[model samples]
Target: MALVCFGIDKFPDHCNFVNGGDGSVSTQTVEKTSTNRKLAPRYRVLLHNDDYNPMEYVVQVLMSTVPGLTQPQAVSIMMEAHTNGLALVITCALEHAEFYCETLKNHGLTSTIEPDE
Candidate 1:
């Protein structure tokens, strides 16, 4: 049950050795990798105001179509769209954004996807 610290200056970028109660010693190494690759571009899922779709229907569609959208969040988005001409529902990867946009459209709600700045 003895704990020994090695290369404390390096902290998390170093290795750790632990002694178990069964008289066994284990070695664990912590590694950090630096990647130069850029992340995938994100897209914005926008809900457009419409005359045909009801407010409640828009909220329901937004909550169902987009993942991680809460009821209050959906209502806020719907209200935004109602007040303005459009509202941003979410910012996510292109495929996910497209899927959400399509799902909203299928539910008779006006939605679109555009590259996020």
Candidate 2:
């Protein structure tokens, strides 16, 4: 008599066995579940204030790179960046965030990505 276990670890939390005489084979379904927990460090792309960069240019950058930000929203964020010295441009995976920061820099705007505190 042999038993087969599926969809579970080698040492299953539960087990099922089948009899040879019966025509039906027993199936065991093991599901691994997970909840959203703060696992890895998250990153945020930020725009920093600069005396040299024009506010309109910052607004343009925000409108171009940061999705879903309207002209007004972009202007608001840019103004915050100006007054507060830093403003969040976007939140995403580190690679993407870093790419955005670099792109902002390439566009002659001061930007950076750091782990969200």
Candidate 3:
């Protein structure tokens, strides 16, 4: 793509400059659009199992740190971590993921977050 820009404007990305044949400067409006709405990048909160914290405590933390997590779901996540050494606690936006990860850490649990592929 080739572009010839004149001066910096408020809407630099959406405007183009062109020289008119009559020696006049004209501004062309080129709308930038996206066919699909951009989705927020998601992050994965991971729980790493250890021999220190008790299984029941882990389940409780999972349920308390993340809202709307039922007991069965918490148990499943805890059991997965216990059996597999690691488990995905939740997939959400960065702020929520960070909050959840920090909350889990505050509760004496090993947790981390990574970009969800």
Give the runs in model 2 whose Cα sits over 4 Å from its true position.
1-40
Q: What TM-score would you give candidate 1 relative to the actual structure?
A: 0.69
Most accurate candidate by TM-score: 3
Show the colliding residue pairs in model 1: none
Give the clashing pairs for model 3: none
Candidate 3 residue-wise lDDT, 63-89, digit = tens: 889999999999999999999999999
The sequence of per-residue lDDT tens digits that candidate 2 reaches over residues 8-48 is 66646555555566667664555566867886667999989
TM-score of each: 0.69, 0.66, 0.70
Tens digit of lDDT per residue, candidate 1, span 50-113?
9998898888888888778899999999999999989999999998998998999899888888
Lowest lDDT 10-residue stretch of candidate 2: 6-15
TM-score of model number 2: 0.66
Error of 2 at 91 (Å): 1.8
Query: What stretches of model 1 exceed 4 Å from their correct place?
Result: 1-34
